[model samples]
Target: MADYSQSPLELLLANQQKGYVGIHVEQGVPVLDRDLNLLQDLISATVRAVISRYVGNGAAAGANGFAVQALPTGQNGQDFLIAAGDAGGPGSALVGGVEVVIPAAVTYRSQPGLPALTAPTAAQPDPRTDTVYLDVSLAEVDGTVDAELNNSRDVGVQTSVRLKPVWVVRVSEGDAVPAPPSGHSFYPLASLLRPRGVATLEAAMIGDLRQRRLTVSDMERRMSLMERTLLLPAFTAPAPGQPQFVPKSGVIGQPITLNGSNFAVAPVTVRFGDLPAKIVGGASSTQVVARVPGGLTPGGVSAAVRITVSNLGGAVISDDTFTADPAPAFAEPTTQFSPGNGTPGTQVTLNGFNFNAAGTQVRFAAVAATVVGVPTATRMVVQVPAGLVPAGSTNADVKITVTNPAGSIVSDDPFRAELNIPAPTFATTPPQFFPKSGVAGQQPIILNGNNFNFAPVTVKFETFTAVIIGTPSATQISVRVPAGMTPPGTTKDLKLSVTTAGGTATSTDIFTING
Candidate 1:
């Protein structure tokens, strides 16, 4: 016969006194105290109130599973017990008038490996453990368990018993489970349990356990420690005293120093916009020297320029602080005219660095010359302007200037312009013929002139032509009169003429031809 003299709480306390079972406490007092009726009423009212909010529907509420055992206090105040049914299986009962499903067996393990359940059998020749694999599958929200567990009545019950799934291992008797031939030793049933999902659940439970004992300050301290250990590279705005590139602005190809923190020893790349700057010397954690890339434009007036540093971790870009100034310099002229001399209408090519084709201006002395075509950054073609230097101007040392938006530069060497001489002309005083006149078929007569070109010369007498016999000098030429040059009259007046590459010249004095 059942003894109804003592209540369930009294029985539990008596059992605990006998060392048969344990008793839970709250604030140093047994949870199930002499006021058993009040404790029951509190539990019943809390459960009923929680379910009333979800009544009318078949939805389950209150604790996940409930039992009448004296659970340890602060083990998770929300965790309830599970009751046994009449058939010794999971019971379908209304605790505090709230329906609940008490699983047949509820267990949990917090360690890495599961325990041995069964002794070795002859047929199996391996250890086997009976396990009730609970899939406890829940839809994840926001990739975290917080949303799924938030305001949900499914609270985890703290239990010392390990609840790992059944693992069937084939091993010899009295020997430990042999190491797996390859891969991992634990081979689980895919359909029964998802290893990845289980791992995620385990991680979440560990976080929850940690959170239970941690205060707000403790959590903050732990977060700070994690941030320190991460060692993520950071780039801050350059300050006054910090190590940074000198001369924030410079021309392309100019060397600049970079001072900062957290730079790698090797494999570091510095960039100006998309163009890579040439690194100079070695780089340490806090300093680097690099030359500005030539890819930058002469006048960076349109867009901002950003400098970037890239290493093993990642890349960091600086604010648009650096500038690229134009640096137009003279390399050399294309034509190898010595002393940099050229005549009018002569095409002169100037080659130098940072020459803007469209914006560059080439000057001979103070006069701007005609640019042949669109000049390149390094080369330019221009024609010397007419009368740039006077015919006999001794001041031939004129400056050859090149100007652009960035700046202007003059040639280090001087350019010379020479004087131009006139063509040949004849003198009028000298008698054109040695004799008074030359008869037809007579000896040759000598003609005189000035400014004659150094080429073959031809002489003529009136309408009759003369034949040149010897080489002609700049002042004299010898020629024979034609046979029919004389007229029927006794004498005739005829003029003599001389022709050369320079030009044709006629003697002012006439000669008399005899019949």
Candidate 2:
């Protein structure tokens, strides 16, 4: 037998044939013939067979032997003989060859004191093999288990069977291994072995062979049980007085830390209610820093939202709900009101984002405006409420504020509020109409007043209309009385009035018209 413990180069040199191209062995009878050509062919065939077994069977064959038949000689009975001086030298001599002999078949047997039906418990490192082995039993095979069998005569043909043991290893839950299916605890060692079919023996085996098979099965079952009992990872909520989230309450987009145990050292997802929050930095087994998700309502004012963390193991929800405070933001209003000023009763339109439809209010300086109707989140219509500014003030510059339960935001610029003009009034000493008693169209009347510079002014005399003769001044206007005022010589009393953008003003004193 070759000493496999030696290095490949050393082993090859130790088995090298002398003056031949193959390995040679010395025994009672030679294990390899000395014929150079035959020896070379035998070595080549053996190597090829071993390689084929490894490739075709997916593993190296254990406890197997190869047979090499001797080559037949030619008719001259000197076919393998070489003549002197044929090659190398003329002094070369023919070397006598030994006949090869096959060794007797042997059977493996379990030695006495071998471990019974129990998994090996002692682990020892074998540096020569670079592997860890379990020391359990000392088994001697080759039918030498009993002293009486050492000298026993050869009997029936020995049958051999290969033993392929499957190994199951347990690792910590933190190890990078695919999780087994639910309710199971073991995963196959994918790098070491694969499933294959087993062939049945054609002939019946003796009592010893049957007992050996049972023993192997018992050991395999016990090893499987040990693997199945491996500890599974566990998770528990933080103990009392431990912080769950640092500074628990905050506005949206604020970063907060979540502290817990048994968190997988992998990517974890955080959710605020049904919305996913942005994770800041990274997550570890005990701490994760995350940002508060937007769209969460303020606590007390609105229902609190549940916070959850999910990882490979499973998902865990915080017992206490996360309280998100309201954050309000405002944008510029849409349309520019004509004159950029208004008083009480003026309808104003506001456009912006993040406005609360139900509890939103618009304020001018410190005074609140009357919302026309239910406001939308992005738009609202409000009326400038009374007392927004002092009664006599011409205009007031004040900040426009939008308030909601979340918070309040003020416009970057101020809005101007102008005083409303009262109805037009006649001067204390009212202007008189010239030609108090004049026939219609026969004469034109001239009226004088104050505050009449506004365009589109009109003048009326009782029920009769008048036409302005020319452009009206701030204090005076000329008009021709309508011919229909009355009959040509009829007399009647008529009230004169003037109208402008401010409003209408009538003359308290009446004038008598002559027909």
Candidate 3:
């Protein structure tokens, strides 16, 4: 339960207003718990309603004792200041009938807001407004009970409940207090405001936690719990040999290994919520294998189910609860993909049945591909990630793996990646270069073709490097023979071109060198 409603507290008070010295004990645990609660509430309500007003140093000087302080300029921080104060207020206050007391002064230092303080922003320049309140809660304390095994001690370390007092500050974004938020309470002792991206805070902008009186009944209406629910564990922990399921969570009709007492002696029955589950063969006294019942409705939030175990001797309800998942679908292999071969960034669509509705991933070979959006049951689109295949290579075939939480589907046929980079070609006069012939170092030769994606296209004559002139366009280029080319060996033909990230493109047309 997130919080207790007031009916339980009111019942306790009404019993005492009558003539009972103490509450009656009927149901062992619950009755004793009720008596403790009644006394606790009486003390809480008395503190909140009667002694709630400040007691010590009623003068404004002492009234501001617990007033929190910080730099006038805004800054991110957890530390704040409390002056050597002279006064104190009620030690406890009742919140929704639960009494909270404070052992120290109510300040943001010792007891910061439950959710902690939030930074300010430009759009909202107001500092975080907060009110300080005394809170007293019960904490379980443990002490070793080892004195003498027979005389003073009964067990190992034993646990006892004790009241803990601390300061609690309720936070509000607005200047005025609306209502207190349960579980998620926060506050700022000093207002931290951000306007135009620069934080600006001033002393007058801060909320007067004390020394300034504010109306309480005005905002006394009960408030709901915050986004996060504050939990007080039944103050218990799970022990071994308790009923447990192997797989604690899964889709409907999934198998669960349930282990408990006395299952082999007689036919045992297991139920998830109201649906009966099938108990597999080979049952043991302490173990029973079963499957989560099918047909339970799992909606947007999923379904919560309780497992009930029954046998010839008696029926026992499981302390652990199982969450029922919605229908499950295993993705199926896709044989057909569109435009299977191309450069990276080409989007491929896979056609298949029963593709996972969400969290579906597509991988081409070892490299993972990008999924376009949420995949439907029959269709999925993905973009090939960069560098699937090297340029100038033959078409590469890569297996496609589509998967989700349910399962994976790998295609027998592979997706093909053929990089768009092609080998260089040349503009030919009949069958040779445009110029046909040139001197080793002085003549200009023009070679033009396609796939000239690289810069500084180098032209060669035999074993010598030619000097390229200006820039080389994708389809045209002009070059001169190497500077040292002499009348001897420089007068022979050789291949000319350039290599780049797109691959080496060598011109097919050979240039004739002249002496």
Best by TM-score: 1
What is the C-alpha local distance difference test score of each model? 0.52, 0.50, 0.53
Candidate 1: worst 10 consecutive residues by lDDT?
Answer: 203-212
RMSD vs true structure, all candidates:
30.2, 30.0, 25.4
Against the hidden true structure, what lDDT does model 3 obtain? 0.53
Choose 1 or 3, whichever is better by lDDT.
Answer: 3
- For all predicted structures, in order, the TM-scores are 0.31, 0.28, 0.26
Off by over 4 Å in 3: 1-33, 53-64, 72-79, 82-119, 125-160, 181-196, 200-204, 211-515
Clashing pairs in 2: 488-515, 489-515
Q: What is candidate 2's local distance difference test score?
A: 0.50
Misplaced by over 4 Å in model 1 are 1-237, 241-243, 253-255, 261-271, 276-295, 298-303, 308-320, 326-341, 349-360, 372-380, 386-399, 411-515
Tens-digit lDDT track for model 1 on 1-515?
Answer: 11233554455445445644222346876543334433443454445545434332121222222222222444422122223343556533332223434446332332225452233345542222221221111111321323443334455422111112222212122332334431122211111111221211121121110011123354455567655434323445567666356768887567877766566534688998888988988877777778877646643232247778877455677753677766656653433223366667777777665676347777887888888877666677788776665542423567688887777777776677543433556666766557657688777677666755445456778767788867776677677877676557788887777766556777778788888
Residue 320: error of model 1 in Å? 4.5
lDDT of 3 by residue, 101-150 (tens): 34345334455345554455555544344443333233322232233322
For candidate 2, the 10 contiguous residues with the lowest summed lDDT are: 201-210
Superposed by TM-score, candidate 1 places the C-alpha of residue 133 at a distance from the truth, in angstroms, of 42
